[model samples]
Target: MLSGNTKFLQGVQIYLLSRDHSNLKSDFRHGNGKIMVNCIENQPAAELVLGKHVFLSVAEYYLRTKTG
Candidate 1:
């Protein structure tokens, strides 16, 4: 997990990363680059809360995969 100064900003970072990862190719070709850039501009509080839930979901997935 992130710590200290980074912890505060991690959620927004994750949201942007998740949004970009979902919408754009690794190379970021075509129009998705614009959408990715736009989605990251606002940084809403709700998205931060949602991002924390997403982190929990990811941890659960990894734990289940490891156990099974």
Candidate 2:
């Protein structure tokens, strides 16, 4: 069983791996925050298993720490 943070990071890596550079840049500039939050929020089982506010906390941290 993966930890919530590990799952989230893996999800992000998998998601990024499926996109092209241009699309990734567009997502970053546009609706990436909402998209990421939605992705995490949609995983109900993961949320329940992790036993924390995984989506919001991860999203907030990602936003605050991510850089070019």
- Index of the highest-TM-score prediction: 2
Query: Listing every candidate in turn, what is its Cα RMSD in Å to the true structure after a full C-alpha superposition?
Result: 9.4, 9.1
**Candidate 1 whole-model C-alpha lDDT, 0 to 1:** 0.42
Give the per-residue lDDT of model 2 (tens digit) for 1-68.
23556666677556556667566545545753323423544443321211122223455557656741
Q: List runs of model 1 lying over 4 Å from the truth.
A: 1-5, 21-68
Which residues of candidate 2, in runs, are more than 4 Å off?
A: 1-4, 31-37, 40-68
| Tens-digit lDDT string for candidate 1 (1-68) | 23354544665466556665544333333532222222434443332222222333476557756876
Residue-pair clash count for candidate 2: 0
RMSD versus native structure for model 1? 9.4
CA shift of 32, model 2, Å:
9.0
Any residue pairs clashing in model 2, and if so which?
A: none
Sequence-dependent TM-score of model 2: 0.39
**Stretch of 10 with least lDDT, candidate 1:** 46-55
